[model samples]
Target: MVKCCSAIGCASRCLPNSKLKGLTFHVFPTDENIKKKWVLAMKRLDVNAAGIWEPKKGDVLCSRHFKKTDFDRSTPNIKLKPGVIPSIFESPYQFQEHSYSVMDSPKKLKHKLDHVISELEDTKESLQNVLDREKHFQKSLRKTIRELKEECLISEDTARRLDVFCWECCQESTE
Candidate 1:
């Protein structure tokens, strides 16, 4: 069966002459993360349900949607490189991910968008803080474990004999 480009506004197909020009058809990536990306590149909001896209068996994208680096042409059968994503799209509508409410003026829309961006930034900052704290806690926990292991072999001693308190936690407040 002839595979066609699944991307929006693309009509390229795997024809006799198409292959002579190095045109190739690629199935959607089996990797869920990569497959989602290809689906998003299709620029069809209707393709996804519950924020996930499930590609049909016939779903395929042509070579024109990717950069040269996206493919590994070294082998006789050209294959896509690891983690390569489709970057090219023909439709102008593909780039839009948001639409302002009809009730709002342009200025109001801009203000609302700015407010949403600020909230996103704040959330990102908070998530980073939590991750930073987790990293530091892990580091301190590792240090404590190392010390305890050194004092009494963890395998043999069962870590009961060694005082297991974290050094960072026990330290006097510098402030």
Candidate 2:
């Protein structure tokens, strides 16, 4: 006869004695010397989560748990609240995308604002340089014109020449 797993939500049945059912059993306390070790081991096999164990008659204990008995010993004492599943597993891709979206979503707006501020600063700086150069050029041209007039080097007929010279000098100053 086979026994069904007493574990909640588990439908696994006990290994059958028939070859088809494929159940294997080992002699309990395989060695007299190991018996003491196993007895000590079983004391530690505590499954905290399941709170119980359903073992079949003559079932060989797994070697992995040979040293420890209470299978649920390390599991947390966490109980699911009413109407809620105990496990919460999210897809890896969804978690990756969600993390990216959370971290990157705000950066988009911040980057745009930073660009705008930089453009404004550049514009302000360029305008100030232009204004400063213009003022210097105006002052230099006025002084040059006043000197030429006082020295009688500038005549009404040479007005165009003076204008050309002043324009070239102003351009050179800017460069």
Per-model TM-score, in order, reads 0.48, 0.30
Tell me the whole-model lDDT of each prediction, alpha carbons only: 0.74, 0.49
Candidate 2 accuracy as lDDT: 0.49
Candidate 1 error regions (>4 Å): 47-53, 92-175
Per-residue lDDT of candidate 2, residues 78-166 (tens digit): 22122221121223244445544346657786997899999999999998898798878777877787788778888855755776777
Each model's Cα RMSD = 17.2, 22.9
Model 2 TM-score relative to the real fold: 0.30
Please, what are the lDDT tens digits per residue for candidate 1 over residues 106-168?
898899899999999999999888767866876777677667677764743444333343434
Best-fitting candidate, scored by TM-score: 1
Clashing residue pairs in candidate 1 are none
Find the 10 residues in a row with the least total lDDT in model 2: 80-89
Q: List where candidate 2 sits over 4 angstroms from the true fold.
A: 1-104, 156-175
